[model samples]
Target: MDIVWFPLHITLFICSVTAAASEAALAKPNCSSHCGVLTEIPYPFGIGAGCYLDHWFQIICDRTASPPKAFLNVIGLEVLEISVEGTLKVTSPITFSNCSNKPLGLQAPNLEGSPFVFSQKNRFSSISCGGIALMTSLYGSTIGGCLSICDNTNTRVLQPNSCSGMKCCQTTIPLHLSAFNTSFGAVLNADSQMACKFAFLVDHDWFTSNSTNISAISEMDSVPIVLEWSLLDYTNFEIYGTNNWTDDKITNCSSHCFCSKGFQGNPYLLDGCQVPSSVLGQLFLLFGGWWSHKVVRKRKHIKRKKKFLKQNGGLLLEQQLSSGAVNVDKIRLFNSKELEKATDGFNADRILGKGGQGTVYKGMLTDGRIVAVKKSKIVDRGEVGQFINEIVILSQISQGNVVKLLGCCLETEVPLLVYEFILNGTLSEYIHHQNEELPLTWEMRLRIAIQVAGALSYLHSAASSPIFHRDIKSSNILLDEKYTAKVADFGTSRSMSIDRTHVTTKVQRTFGYLDPD
Candidate 1:
């Protein structure tokens, strides 16, 4: 009887220890893993002090609201779901319309100082008898549109999960797009009998749930919009030992990491992410370690691309192209993969030159066209507006002496500009490089100078808008294979109205090229 009692007590002790461990693993020390109905407010996002990574990720749990509502700090958007895959779903109020065409438009949500960005998965959509809506970014770039047309005679047939531009229409926004201005097109008095016009950004998934009836969406006060968030500064290689997550450790850190590849859980926990026993065997045995690592790397690469897209104003660029502001036929938007492959993964051997702004790489596109890719060194928030403006200004340039901006890649941390590769290199290289076997002849130098001068003249007066090439130096002038001079490097360039005689701006130029004034 004594031996049996001893075994029973040992079993009870082991079971108690395991239970405690499980509870501790679920959440960080002194931090609640849940808030009211939201039972899974993971690390990096928390409802209480010491639980969240920072003030930007704080969730305000409003208990007064019936059933309790979770709101992201300052933004005040109602949180519907939080995904560890760097995405969240939130609800936005919509204007309701009964019979009269109620002006239905909501100001875009401002997402400054937060890691959150509007996902491409959310579309600018509308439901109305006949209404045209426009979606523009904070900088006044039109991103997308939703136009719904209807007739008073015909009975409307609504299709679920589809916006075919009849009674309902939808258009896509860019990955990092956040704020937007949505306004309905003015209707003629004849169409005053139209029912209502409703337009707002919405999650793609929500369309399938209740998309059968267009009226159902209009009747509802709010619609769901999907947003993406991430730890942009964190790397995939960072890892920690088992079960060591404490409130004090990651309270201020903005990033968290999973235990290993294929593991799915809160990355902030020591043992949070783990392969389940059920599928772990099959995954490891069939795919092996290399395949698992590859998959994990791919996911990390995708997240990085999304981060770059947001930082570089990808949405605005897309909007410009889609809205016909920029001609896509003449200018292309390259993704990270394309540019990487083009430049041999940006190897040192492929480097063309380096400047204070960034590096240029010699690349070959899939079409066998050799190009120069200018990758910026940094992305200043204040400079983003100017960067977009430059793209617009360059796209309009068709002068023969100006280096053609073939396209750009906004899907990077800093925007990259692609130009027609000048094989002979810059004018400075030919004139200053000691290794140059053939020096420029007097005639060639005079011709090059004339070409550059003509290019500047075209930019200043002949163009639709006046452009000021503030930094006009020998280094900024390139030479094609034919040794014809082509004006390049518009990084410091500015544009003004055709009538403006001069514009006031901070002086920015290379050494030995500054205006004395």
Candidate 2:
């Protein structure tokens, strides 16, 4: 009898193990935010006091309102909805990017160099066939971009709509797009059909079925996006693979960098710290730029980009093709559906951050593609179009300082973009966070600032086609495992001929990081 139960016991054991993992995925960590009403804030995000990663991640939680209200601190975009799947339906910065009879309307501000980014895993899609969309995101290394198309045809009348270059299109972004810019326009092409343009980084599941929010647009006014914000772990300063000599089991965090006590300097450094220095009253410091460097090519397949541009009708594109100085194959495109599964239906459980435009979540695809997901407000009509533009542009440019585009999705009502994930969160979180001050030391901050400058110069002056970062703040600049900086988020970015200095616009950045002008 005992032997007979062996098989059953083994089966039960496997089942129990599976159940545990699932529970962890479903279990929402205690750290959370409480909105006034109708909002639920979960882990990696918090409310006042111990509720968040410091004030920057705090939720307003104004319960006095009838329906309740929550908001991000940086950009006062009102919060409408919050979910455990790491997504929220929020109002757009300029909810309607249409050129209707109204005055020049409000537009989602450009969010670059901020600690936030459009979750490359999230979709910037539209609701119906009568609208066009534009969007932006953080792709590989913080270079911003856009995706747009003069969509108006109802491609989903008889079947599910796909962004297969039809009435729809999509684009990817630099990995750490902390913020984005938004705009909506009528169909610019004669063959294309469109009435209104809608944009936002949406939950593919909700967007595909016209999500409840879209269905109830006539009733409610706005929705909120849960931005999954991140910051670089202090570990990057640990001095891995260094030339310094040492062979001792030691920890340098001093228990301050989220480690146990009996520690010393910043855990991010090699010998973190041990009683100042034996040099008595003097301390030593190194002056090299980077511990190591990897030089990547800065050119794309000029022919392919020209083909895509001509197919897409980018005037600046033809010129690039003529130059025959870049390679496009290096750019990648990803599927929207895959990103959906990766983000667990854009559940609130995976959220790592939130900010001016939307919320961001951490995602792990089936093939182990880890990513940060940015969700924009439902009102940004240009969300989808901007996504497509970003993919097209990133694929055509090659620069060491620039982030690379991976791929994008547009099969559902909303569109989803994909890109390599940057592990760190944003500069805001690191610099101002009350958690621990050990990470942003003299060396680390300088390294970060320098890396950012390199990327900015590349985008402004070096990119084959002159590009504008538009928003060059700290949040959009993401950090990697080695603490190296990677520029991010180009949702509001624009491309122009080398001869042009600035594009026509009045899109502003967040309060603190705005341009001096």
lDDT of 2 at 385: 44
- TM-score per model over all chains: 0.44, 0.35
Candidate 1 residue 397 Cα shift, in angstroms, is: 99
Among these predictions, the greatest lDDT belongs to 1
| Ten contiguous residues minimizing lDDT sum, candidate 2 | 286-295
Q: In model 2, which runs have C-alpha deviations exceeding 4 angstroms?
A: 1-328, 378-383, 434-437, 502-504, 511-517
User: What value of lDDT does candidate 2 attain over all alpha carbons?
Assistant: 0.50
TM-score, predicted candidate 2 vs. hidden true structure: 0.35
Compose the digit string of candidate 2's lDDT tens values, residues 154-213: 333322524444434445544544555444444556443434444545434443463343
| lDDT tens digits, residue span 42-129, model 1 | 6667767776666777888888977888888878888888776578888876644443444444465887657778888887887776
